[model samples]
Target: MRPDLELVANLIQTDARVLDLGCGDGELLHNLQQHKSVIGYGLDKDAENIGLCLAKGVNVIEQDLDEGLGNFQDDSFDMVIMTETIQSVHNPLLLLQEMLRVGRECVVTFPNFGHWRCRLHLAASGKMPVSAHLPHRWYDTPNIHLCTFNDFEALCAHLNMLILQRRVVNRHHNERSLINLAPNLFGSYGFYHLGRTT
Candidate 1:
């Protein structure tokens, strides 16, 4: 598992129901089913990834997340997880609302747009940053709604969601003292565990 996924896996309770949005190849789901005994289903739009999921004996569905997760009923799962898929979605606010509606909690991970490297690159070259973390150019990037940690927290506040946990880490998903000093300026990515307050 990716180090970030390792962090995500830690947040889950054993034997819980989970829904993984934009699950690329069912790696996390497979790991969860084996180690945590989690009952989970992965959702993805790519046919090849779906094939890989089936091969792994993972329960998966083919679907575009941008449309909505309407096929699932309310409070259907214990947790809803979306890793690195928020920026690509059409309506992040609605997606989050739906996630919380269908599950008691949600976990989200995304590249930090407010990192110092991105800011420095933009200010220096006057063009969008194209680095290891965000390798795509502006014209071809799948990320449509890139945002900062502060931006996401504000949105959560607007929706009355409670932030259960938050972590800012380097590209390797490792935490260092520098990152803790000023996460917005140092950390390359962010991981958040959230829930409805009400």
Candidate 2:
């Protein structure tokens, strides 16, 4: 499991039901099921990933997340998780709302576009930075809605969601306490635990 996913697993209560959106290859779900005794269903658009999930005995569905979560009823699960995928979605805010609607709480992680390295690289090279966290060119990158820590917090406030916890990690996915000094500029990735306002 990615270090971030391990951290995410720590946030989940044991034996809870979880929904993982864009759950690549079901690694996180598999970990959650095996280690935490949680019941998890993964959703991914890729057939290969779904096959991997099936091989691992993890329940998975194939669907584009941007299409919306029409099948799941409100408050159907204890938690919904979207790891390192929010930036790739077409309408992140709408997806977030749907996530909150279907689950009591949601966990999200995204690459921080406002990291100083990205800014400095862009300033120096006059091109998009291709680092370990964001390793794609501007034209081909899937990250459409890239944002910073502050931007994400502002979005949460705007949506009237309650942020239960927040962590800033480096490119290696380890929590860095010094990053808190200037998370928007220093953090490479952001992990957020959020709940509905109500």
Highest TM-score model number: 1
lDDT of each: 0.94, 0.92
Give the C-alpha lDDT of model 2: 0.92
Clashing pairs in 2: none
Consecutive 10-residue window with the lowest summed lDDT within model 2: 172-181
Kindly provide the TM-score of model 2 when superposed on the true structure, using C-alpha atoms: 0.96
TM-score of each: 0.98, 0.96
Model 1 misplaced stretches (Cα beyond 4 Å): none
Model 1: per-residue lDDT, tens digit, 1-198? 889889889888999999999999999999999999999999999999999999999999998998898988999999999999999999999999999998999999999999999999999999999889999999999999999898999999999999999899999888999999999889899999999898
Each candidate: how many clashes?
0, 0
Name the lDDT value of residue 16 in candidate 1: 95
Cα RMSD of all models vs. native, in order, equals 0.8, 1.1
Clashes of 1: 0
